[model samples]
Target: MQLPESQVAVLEAASADEATSIDALAEATDLPPETVTGAAFELEEEGLVEVSERVDETIELTDEGHEYATDGLPEVALYEAALEAGADEEPVSMGQVIGQSGLEGDAVDIALSNYARKGYGSIDSGEITADPDAEPTADAEANALEALADGAVGTDDDLEEVIDQLERRGLLEVVETTTRDVALTDEGVTELMGGIETTETVGAVTPDLLTSGEWETVEFADYNVEADAEDVESGTVHVLRQMSERVKDVLVGMGFQEMDGPHVDADFWINDCLFMPQDHPARTHWDRFAMEEPSHIDELPDQLVADVERVHREGLGEDSEGYHSPWDEEFARALALRGHTTSLSTRYLSGEEIGEIEPPARFFSVEKAYRNDTLDATHLLEFYQIEGWVMAEDLSVRDLMGTFEEFYAQFGIEDIQFKPHYNPYTEPSFELFGTHPTTGELIEIGNSGIFREEMLEPLGVDCDVMAWGLALERLAMLTTGAEDIRDLHGTLADLEFLRNAEVTY
Candidate 1:
């Protein structure tokens, strides 16, 4: 059988009668370690050789060990230097002894401490004195370094004790390395005895060869279908980001136009315009993250500002009675990180940028929001909020329920229940819940209601408008089938879950 030069070289070097390591084969064939390994794998796939792997524990010298192997051990060097400096008469200054020994940095401390511990010398008050009768002989550590100087040393009872001491001193390191042994099969022996021939074969077809029609004339190497291959790490969108894009597609498919707004906005657009009173519990310091820089905004239109103030101070039309406590324009302009993306909806509905909102105008935003929430299994300080609103000349509670049914149906969530709820801005509000696919427990998904006139008139949206705000992460949790919210997205998210997660419908 014909083979490439590398494979033939490996076959000739590997023995049929005895197992030979890949390193030994490489040495015999004068090839690189990686080349020898690849050749062995290819030969093994061809049934001409067998490769066996064994994990070997090797003890080798560290940087410190190499230094000690060349120069004497730190303690031995200090003892010799101390002996020369003083003949048991005068104590040598530690600084002078360190300078004479040619050691620096931590080596000086290591030498002095070991020298005293080994009974070779005494260190007292910045001075060192060598023992009078102590002879300069190589310690067990020095002998171990010599044994390992050539390469790795095998562990034995005698050498093990020395290894322990050397390892404790950080002079040696033990590592586990997988070594592959290659042995020729009977077929390989027969082929070698039959005189193996090397051939010039193309391993890969190049574009030039293909274009020139030269590949047909050249002999191609036989493909080893069972050979080991390198691992591939292809680029992929982050799981959370992929879910966000899917959400955007779903919304757009439902005829909702995407909306964008600032992450930091004035309280007027965020809370005040939403009919949240100035002294509402949600606006307190413990609930919201207030920004320090660019402290406030002052560009609100005078008429819109006055309209919102009037809604909060008095009432909107006859059916609406405003908060009736107080409304402060200064408080409205105060800047903070938005607590919800509804701030964007409020802006679009109030500002003329979206133009006159005729019936059936739908706007949605999937954007980030910030809060002062403690991080846990169910809460995160920052997350994406899916905020949306639908406007029509005449709408009812049934319209809101039908919209949610159609929206969640796209995600394969069929069972939904609504419970009567109370919100400051929605007159007849309801909390939306979906039965968890795995847990069988009803989970609160979002809150929705028909916008009260007090909240809508300030935004200049006169028609019936239904608004809802939901957590994007919660939807992602359902899509990815995550048990805990943290497993879907957070600092503590499960990496394995993200790697293997395939977002379901």
Candidate 2:
């Protein structure tokens, strides 16, 4: 790998006295900031220098690492000693062997095991032994035996000899007379360390070490290091989160006070007060996440309950008459995962504080709503909804439509069409649709309308209350070009997918 000269200079200039930032190194070495940083990272991977804080890219090294710069140990010796030390003990774990042997963590585990099999030591379950007489079965033999017991037939004299040797050295002992355990001897440690010394003596360091005159050299090796990759630039926020924030910003900008509510709600506020009958089809298992705990509404206002009963019994002027069924107070009190953020709006409207509020009060909420729906490309079990209410003497359906258009325009969606729709809660309700830029397909984005008198009268909302809401996930999916809802939160480490995603607005 070719490294920039600046990076090479940084490696050479790194000292105990002075540390340099990537910016400073870039200025001194006449390289771009990015280039200097990249070079520093490359040098770091080569084990020549250490980089701390990539934001500043400070270069430093551990004290022992400094010594490695001047007098590097032989790789063979390092491997052998690691194996021997590991084998000499009760089979020290590979991690412990690397730590004790002063070898790099990567490749050392495999190297030590190879050395053990070469008569330097034995490795089993990450433990190493260096005793020559230790009857540590080679990894291959042990694996073969395991495979045989698992219904495979394979045998070799060498494997038998290794087993016998292990038995003779008393390294192999029966545990509960069922399984054999391999133990290492003290001699194994000495042999492993001796192997390192022998290997190092046979050409480990460069000749320049003996007669150096400004000699420049590069060492190349590969090993797995558990280092996090450089952080790459990517757009901020998920599409849903961005949409939610935008909605909140717009509502807050328009003098609307945000309201918070629990995800679990009693059916009373969600349905009964809204004039929805207790036996409404929406209360079925297919429509909601019914909760077992706190399955009762204990503190509904008596006046509101009586008003709701009146509305359900006699259609509050919208229809000639209500269904007139007995209001099932128990059913109305059942707990459920709120199906919409409008539940918060409804709750706020029903409270005494809402009655005391000045005319033209506005409120909004962006929260997760739960539903029991089969997973699909455009559907999710849980999703965010941007719900806002405008309660004023003059709030009209046109105002709601204008708000929808302005909010969607923030996401670069210009064309919006509305179709009349039936909603028990709103008069002149309309389903809003937006054209998908790529597919040119019209998609229903959300629903909006002025609150019906039957729905608002009991809550003391006397003026026209216009509200509009949509799922945030649908917006994000369209904006991010995410074909699957799951892609919004990637499952793998490939940052390129996120980096390459195009954000229109």
Which one is best on lDDT?
Answer: 1
- Tens digits of per-residue lDDT, candidate 1, 451-471, equal 888888877777899989987
TM-scores, each model vs. reference? 0.61, 0.54
The alpha-carbon lDDT assigned to residue 252 of candidate 2 equals 81
lDDT of 2 by residue, 271-291 (tens): 776667766767676478888
- lDDT of candidate 1 vs native? 0.82
TM-score of 2: 0.54
Q: Give the Cα error of residue 413 in candidate 2, in Å.
A: 1.3
Model 1 worst lDDT run, 10 consecutive residues: 372-381
How many pairs collide in each candidate, listed in order?
0, 10
Report how far off residue 382 is in candidate 1 (Å): 3.1
Cα deviation at 271, candidate 1, in Å, is 0.7
